[model samples]
Structures are given as C-alpha cells and as structure tokens.
Target: MHRTAPRLARILACAAVPVMLVASGCSSDSDGKPKAEKSQKSEKTDKAGSSGGAALATPESEKKPAVAPVKFTKLPEACRSLKPKTIEKLVPSTKAKAGTPGRSTDLLTRGSCSWNGLDDNGVKGSQYRWLDVSFLRFESDAALGTSGKQRAQEAYTKEVAKNRATTGAKNVKAAPSAGVGEEATALSYQLRKTGEDFSYVTIVTRTDNILITLTYNGTGYAGAKPPAVADLLKDAVPAVKETVTSVTAANK
Candidate 1:
C-alpha cells in the first residue's frame, strides 16, 4: 500500500510539467516573447492605425469636390430676339422681316436665324445685305456631364476662330468688344459674295452658359458702294447687346 501511494504521487508531478509550461506561455520563437503578446502586436498592426500615429485613406464622401453653377435656364426665340428696326437695317428690303429660323431639336440648347435681301433701284443700282444670329446654351448638371460655363467658353473660342478663318477673306481684323456682354470679340473682313465685295462683321459674346453669335454683312452691286465697316459695327453692337439682354429676360 505504501509503495502504491508513492508511485501515484510521482506520476501526478510529471503530468503537471506540461500545464506549467503552457501557463508560462512557452513558444518556439527565440525572442523570449510570449505567444499571446506576439498575437496582440500582430492584431494591432493589422488595424493599420489605432494610436493616432497614422491615419487611414480619406473617403470620397468626406473629400472636397469641384463645383460650378450655370445661370439662365432657357434660350430666347431665334427670330424675335432682334427689334424691327434692327432687322430692317441689317437686311434691307427683306422678303420676311420676321427672319428665317434654323432647325433645332432643343431650343434650350441652341437656336439660329438668318436673313438676306436685295434692294433694287433698276438703273440706279442694287444693294445686297445678309444677317444671321445664333444662340447656344448649356446646363451645369453632374448627370449630363461637365461644367456648363466651361463648355460654352470653349465653344466661344472655337466659333470666333472659325469666323476669322473665312476662306478668301480680305482686310480681316480682330478686337475686343466692350459693353456688349460678359465678354465679346469682334471680327471684320471683306468677302466677295453675291457678285459683290461684301463687308462682314461677326460679334461673338457670352453671358454665363449662353453664347451669342451675330453676323452682319452687306454688299453693293451694279455701281453701288458697299456699306462702311464702321457703320456695320456700330449697328451690330446695339443689336448684340439687345440679344444678351433677351437671354436674361427669358430666364426671368
């Protein structure tokens, strides 16, 4: 009985060795670090940042974004934007004083009109004239894509350059126009059309997202003198200013 008791005590002590090693947190790593401590450090690093030492990437919803607003909601009528006297002066002896409208799928985005006339005086002489007006509008919508004013500004530059590059143009001149709109450009030149040397003046202006292009040209045939460029410019300024005003009026 005494030998059996002693043997049982030895066996219990040997079994407790493994429990002691586990409680002490023994591991194969040579750094002397407990397995639990190593696991804790690894977990913290996985979190990327937790102690304010480093920050996570910013979320899109929290970042600052670019934005631009567009003014004016619609465009004016292409044919009625100009006054009766203005039309008469631009296109003398007109077939239709109301002007001819262009095809447009969306008036809020674009509109245009044109007029041409020949004033006949038989043996005295014959005078010819032509006029055109176009308006383009844009909207600042994220869904529709891009900024409205930016698009119009690009179009404004393109249109002005195109007019100044007219084929077979003579004495072409360019200058900034004032008191017309937010910004405007005037291009004057001479072109032989309708069997006469016609004076051409194109006024390109913009107000917000809307671009206004006004062209006035006149020529003389059968010994008649073409109209002065200065006179045409003077008349064009008022007519263009009125068109810009009409855009503002349409929105109001």
Candidate 2:
C-alpha cells in the first residue's frame, strides 16, 4: 500500500505540472500579444501626432502682404511725345523733324528725345537752339518694399540736385513753378561753350510715378545777342506743360 500510494502521488504531481504549464502558455499568448499590439499602436500614434504638430509651425513672414500697384505701366514713345508744331517752334529749322530718339535697351522704364537746329539769318547772326526731353517711370518693387510714386519722388529730387551742380554753370537759379504737373521746378543757368554764351532752362516735373525733364538751351552766333532767361522759360514752361499733358493722354 505504501509503494502504490507513492506512485499515485508522483503521477498526480506530473499531471499538475502539465496543467500549470498550459495555463501559463495561455496567459502569455493573451496578455503578451495585447501588450505588444498596444505598445506598437501607441508608438504609431506618437509619430503621427509629432508629424501633425510640425506642419503647423510656419513663420508669419512667409505670408507677406501684397505690394501696392503702380499707376503708370507704359511709357510713351520718346520721339512722338511732343507735337511737331511744338517741336518746330522750340527748335526752329531742325534737321530731324521727327526728333532723334535716344538709345535705350528698354523703352518701358526710361526714354528720351532731342531736337537741335541753327536758324541762320544772313550777317545778323544765327540762332542755335537745342531741346531735349526725358521720361522716367518707376514701378513698385516687392523685394525692395518701395512704392512707385515714392521712388519717382526720390528720382525727381536727385535730378534737381544734379542739374543744380552743373559743371561750369553760372548764375544757377532754381524756382518752383505752378501749372505744370504735380510739382515743377525750373532750373536756369548760363554756360559758355564753343566761344558762345548759352542760356539754359530745365524743367523737371513729376506726375504720379513718372518724371519729365525738359531742357531748352540756346546760343547766338555771328555777334548776335544770346537768348534771355525770360525767353528760355517762356518756351520751356509751356513745353513742359504740353509734355505733362501727354502723359495723361498716353494712359488713356
């Protein structure tokens, strides 16, 4: 009875070992698999959340404001800006009735035209006249952050300063004039060249984003009297008015 009882107890112990092992295996499969799946899901969610947050952190400057538009985009033809009649009266006996167009790679931004003539009058003398007009247009720049009219004003100031500092110019006088454009300045001076005294008058005016600089100069030959400042300005002021008027017409 003692040996049988000991064998039976060994068998029961072996059977209980298998039962515990089965229970442990089932627990590992259920709990370990769920934990692994949950951990993987958590890692994936963390990665997705981090990626979404990175997308929303853009700088404010990346959405810059739009630049203001310019008023004038097209420049008129340099030679045709003035009327033929106006040209004849300003520069009498001009060889080039159509005026000479200044060289320019881009006509949309800057352009110029000039007319010169010598009206001969027998032994009394010859009247020499030269007239030229230049147009400069400014456009709003987004990178530079400057408006077109502001740029034009800067250019106008520079032009006036430059004319004031002409080399060998005498009796330089600058005066603000009305009825020409938004603002007009007449710069007058005397310059002697080629053994003759020349009277020069320059009218610099700015209209919106455009600048019109008109210069009229004359000298007498064969002992004739040089033109007076009044004479130079009489034509210069009107010519500038006409040129300024043309700017409005060109836009229309």
Candidate 3:
C-alpha cells in the first residue's frame, strides 16, 4: 500500500506541472496593458491612395461657366454712313479704295475697303477692307515693308500697342495667329474686359517683309449672353491668333 501511494503522488505532481506553466504564461503581464506594436505601412499607403483619387475626380463643368451666343442686327444707315470716316481714322496712312457691299456668313452686310500706303515704319503697304455695320466691325489693313522683316515686326508691335491704348484694353497676352501655309508666321494680343467685351489685334509677318494686322471685336448674342466683354476678348484673342497663324502658313 505504501509503494502505491508514492507512485500516485508522482503522477499528481506531473499533471499539476503543465497547469502551473499555462497559468504563468497567461498571467505574465500583470499591468493589463496591451503590447506595443509598430505602425502598419498598409494603413499609410491606403490613405495616400485615397487622397490622390479624390484630387483627380474634379469635373470640367465646375471650372468654367458657359458663354451665351450673340444677337446680331443690320446696321442702320447712320451706322453704315460713318464707316468711311472710321476706316480713315483707324488707318490714316492708307488711301481708301472702292469696296463692294455684300452679306457675310456671320449675318452682317459688309463693305470691303482697301488702301495702299507706307506703314508706320515707312514700309510700303496695302490693306483689304471689311466693315460690318451691325457689329461695328472693321478689318481693313494688310501691309508689307520696304525696310525688312524685323522692321515690319517693330512697326506692327507699335501699331498693336497704340490700338490697345486707344481701346482701353485690359488683360492682354501675346498669342499665336493662324498660319497661312507652312512658312508665314502670325501672332497677336488678346484683350478682354472682366464683364464687358472681347477684342483682339493680330500681327502676322513672313520672312519677307509682309506684315498683316487684323483686329476683331464683338459683343455677346441672345442664348449666348455676351460675357463680360473682357472675358470674350480673352477668348477671342487666342482664336484670332490661331487663325492668323494658319493664314500665314497658307500664304507661305
């Protein structure tokens, strides 16, 4: 009986050893605080990705308001009558040539006028005339130089500056005009008023002394209520520049 009692005591001690080890492991952290851990990189990556996605989701409609179309009408006889004098004032040096009256695609009855004379820089010049009474629009100058291409550029620059000053243009920038063919170059200054009107003056020159100055001006139409004239000028300037550039290229 004594031998059996000793063996049973050994067996009980062996079973209690495992329970003690498990209890010690579970209760090791007596302060009840969670283990400190390093920050996860995946969380930062996810945040950065979400921010970038948000930045790219902006819509185009929010960037700019739509512009309204322009309402147009025929120029009254009084308006048409002033055209000759106005053209003379606008281009004083050139001699007026006879013009043909006609209808244009933009819904204006236009009278064409032309002239030949020396440019501001003393270059020989010739110009085509276009006067639209309804919009009070005129484009009547085409010029070339006896001085040289560089002189032509200088003359045109001066002319553009003078026109801008005369018209009280605001928010102006130099831009490309339409090319005539492949070689003729063109450029212009676009002008706009914040809420009033749009207009532009373009200067196109070739390697030859040919310099062409074109001025465009207009108010807004019905469904397309004219934006601030200034904003329209801003938009029109660049467009006219592109057209002049193309024309230059074509002329080449």
Candidate 4:
C-alpha cells in the first residue's frame, strides 16, 4: 500500500508540471500581442510617409527656359517716333500736323501713327502726301526655339513679303538698307489707288526685338507728278533710325 501511494503522488506531480508550462506559454503570447500590433502600425505609418514624401520631391510645373529675357518690353509710340523734320519733309501740307495715332489695345506690343495732307494750287497743280510709322515688340519663346531677335527676324521677313505681295503693284523693288538699326529692307512700288497714281516707300527695320516700319506715300492732284523713289528712300532712312532710337530711349 505504501509503494502504490508514492507512485501515484509522483504521477500527479508530473501532470502539474505540464499544466504550469502551458499557463506560462499563454501569458507570454498575451504579453507579446500588443507589442507586435504596435510594431506593425509603426511600420505602416513609416511606409505611408515615405511614399508621400517622394511625391512632393519633384514638381513638374517648373520648366526652365532656353533663352535669356528680352531687352525691350514696351515699344515706342509709332506716330510720335518720327522726328519733326521727317514729318515736315514727308507731309509738308499735313492738315493735322500733330499727327494721328493708330489704334492698339497694348502700346507695349504695337503702336502706329500717320499724317496726310494736300497742298492745293488752283488752276495749276496740287500735291498730296501721306506718312505713317509702326513699331512692334517681340518676346523670346523657348518652346518655339526662337529668341527675341530670331522672332523679330521672322517678322521682318514676313513684313517684307507682305509688301512685295501687294496686288496691282508696279515697279516693286526690295533692297537691303545700310546704316540703319541692325538690319533693314526698303520696299518701293507704284500702286494706283482712288483714281490717283501713288508712290509707296516702306522700310522694315529691326534692332534687337523691336521692329520699326516707316511708310511714305504721295499722289499728284490736279495735274501733278508722283514723288521720286530715290528721293523718298533717301529721306526715309533717318526717319526709321529716329524711330529705332526712340525704342532704346524708352528702355533706358
């Protein structure tokens, strides 16, 4: 009986050892759950912040331009650009000597002015004259692969082509002008308009981004003669230069 009792007690002690081990493992799992969950949440937050920071690192809207900024911003007043001597010689009998300004929404981009007059000689001859000037400013555009000067050059060629394409024009001639701005072209032709033969002198010039255009035209009234092309071109050079100078003056 004594031997049986000792063996049973030993069996009971071994059974209690397994139960205590199971309890200890359950307590470890319970203590680790909150820490594991907290670690997972921290990892997720870190990943989300990393992704958001990457998106803000680079901005697509900041594009660099290929060229420098243009020098001239505003253009000179077209009509007022011409010198007084030029206006006087071009339109001697101008009714409004102050000159009339052309229409434009933005003077910085473009502007123009003109004058016209008639010197009436009863029973002899009458002379009629007209003069006008125009100015245009160009800006650099990197997208188009053109600087301010290049854009102005294209416009210069276009303006010359436009003058050459004049319909019903007679004796149309285009020649490069010297000693005026960076480059210039003189277009002279004879066009009959309003029952009168008129001589046209157009000068398209460019200095930097600014384009200058000077036009001088005249007709004879009551048995008069047309103005000579040579004389008109000689007088037109300085007038165009004066207009160009006005641009530099404004910039200064």
Tens-place lDDT per residue, model 4, 1-252, is 999999999999999999998876665555566566768888999999999999878654345447767989878667678777778887887878779999999888888999999888877788888888988889998776578888998999899999999999999999999888899999999999999899999999999998888998888888888888888888888888899899988888
Model 2 spans with C-alpha error above 4 angstroms: 1-65
Ranking by lDDT: 2, 1, 4, 3
Over 4 Å off in model 4, which ranges?
1-64, 142-145
Model 1 lDDT tens row, 177-230: 998888899999999865678898999999989999999998888898998999
Model 2 scores worst on lDDT over the 10 consecutive residues at: 27-36
Which of candidates 2 and 3 is the stronger one according to TM-score?
Answer: 2
Q: Count the backbone clashes (under 3 Å) in each candidate.
A: 0, 0, 44, 0
Cα RMSDs of all predictions? 4.5, 5.8, 20.4, 5.9
Q: Which one wins by TM-score: 1 or 4?
A: 1
Who is ahead in TM-score, 3 or 4? 4
Residue 233 lDDT in candidate 3:
35
**Order by TM-score, highest first:** 1, 2, 4, 3
Query: What is each predicted model's overall lDDT from 0 to 1?
Result: 0.87, 0.90, 0.40, 0.86
Inter-residue clash pairs, candidate 1: none
Native-to-model Cα distance after best TM-score fit, residue 120 in candidate 4, in Å: 2.2
Local error of candidate 3 at 130, Å? 8.5
What is the C-alpha lDDT profile of model 3 across 1-252, one tens digit per residue? 999999999999999999998876575445543233113445677889999999988786565543322222232222233334444543334444332234455423222223333223223222222222111222222232123434434655665455545555565555444443113222233344656344443333222333333343433322233224344334433433343343334334
Model 2 residue 28 distance off true place after TM-score fit, in angstroms: 23
